[model samples]
Target: MIIQAVAHRGYPKKYAENTLSSFLKAVELGFSHLELDVHLSKDGIPVVIHDHTLDRMTNGTGRVVDYTASELQSFRVKQDEHIPTLEEVLRALKGKIQLNIELKQMGDYYPELEKRVLEVIEAFDMLDQVVITSFDFDALERIRQLSRDVRIGLITFGGSKAILDWSLEMGATFLSMHYAFVTEHYIQRCQDLGIQLMAWTINESSVMKQFQEYPSVWICTDELEGFMDVLEMSGSI
Candidate 1:
């Protein structure tokens, strides 16, 4: 069994995270799985970004929901990088690889985001290859309501079985969680329940080595090439 690698925000070390350049870099590096974050704009467009506010990643300062998609185009992630619409991302990476689209909606509910994201994915014919994930259990529920065929994942941080229980209740087939929560016992339980496990933000080689035993688990990482090197040295890749 070989552990799979899921590029977190498409190789953030080489390009700005959640941008087209980053995703393209991930594809060039031969990564089959990609993870990204999405937030709905004021005009109901799902934009690819990690934060609720634009200040951290882009020149803009307001909450992402306050600005329309077109308005966000003016704010630059850098001189060359601008905020990308979810449609643009879907078109760019459409047939190249599988995607994990993390919904960024937390407290302020955006009722149309789930519908809009599904619409974009449907247009691109990527429904089967995509997994919709979020820390908000309600958001995952909404996604389940919209389409049972679409894969839904629960993103969590702690090592509690309650998270798995809630994820099961939401009909989630995947659990995306912090690496610290994963254990042999937990992995076995998830396998028993038929839930696939994915560990997030794993960058260290030592930690990567630790998860090699779980061949089916997907390890999400920022250092895509480095993780591959670890696997290569271990003769696992």
Candidate 2:
């Protein structure tokens, strides 16, 4: 069995999450897929970073939407790593790896976020190489409205019939769930329903061993190298 592993936020265990260097390093380590978060800057450019606020991941403060993309890039994530624009990330990793771009919003959503993100993806001619994911169903719906060909994934904390129905209704190509919520039965259910399932942020070897049994399922992890080693030891890769 081959475990399909996605480098979650570009190997956050070793580098700053959502930074360009982090993504490039994941590519250097030979990960087939990379997951990242995107929020529209004040100027409406899609920039990569997890939080709607910058306090957690960068030296800056306040809402990400408050700063222009260029202004946001001025803030340092770690020692010197600047926040990257979606275009910059796509330009660098376009042909090298598949990207799982999460459209992020909390409270009030950013205006034209979905449209701007699609424009960026289209600008790079990477619609086939990328999947847009979000916990915000409305945003995913907006993506669906904009382009039928673009792949969409519904991200949720757990699995349930309601979630499945929602994914099906949205015509989502993938269902991304928290690892703790995934089970063999759920895996089989997704397989039976023709929905591709992905488990996220998995780091434990024991968990990796368990998920390896279902080769059709994808796993996203912060510790990509460690998880890969686990799969290698179990002869699942």
- Best prediction by TM-score: 2
Model 1, position 164: C-alpha lDDT score? 76
lDDT of candidates 1 onward, in order: 0.87, 0.89
- lDDT agreement of model 2 with the native: 0.89
Give every collision pair in model 2.
none
Worst 10 residues of 1 by lDDT: 1-10
Alpha-carbon lDDT of model 1: 0.87
Indicate which candidate wins on lDDT.
Answer: 2
TM-score of each: 0.95, 0.95
lDDT of 1 by residue, 138-222 (tens): 7888888989889998888865778778877877888997998788888888888889889988999999998888977889999
Runs in model 2 lying further than 4 Å from the true structure: 1-3
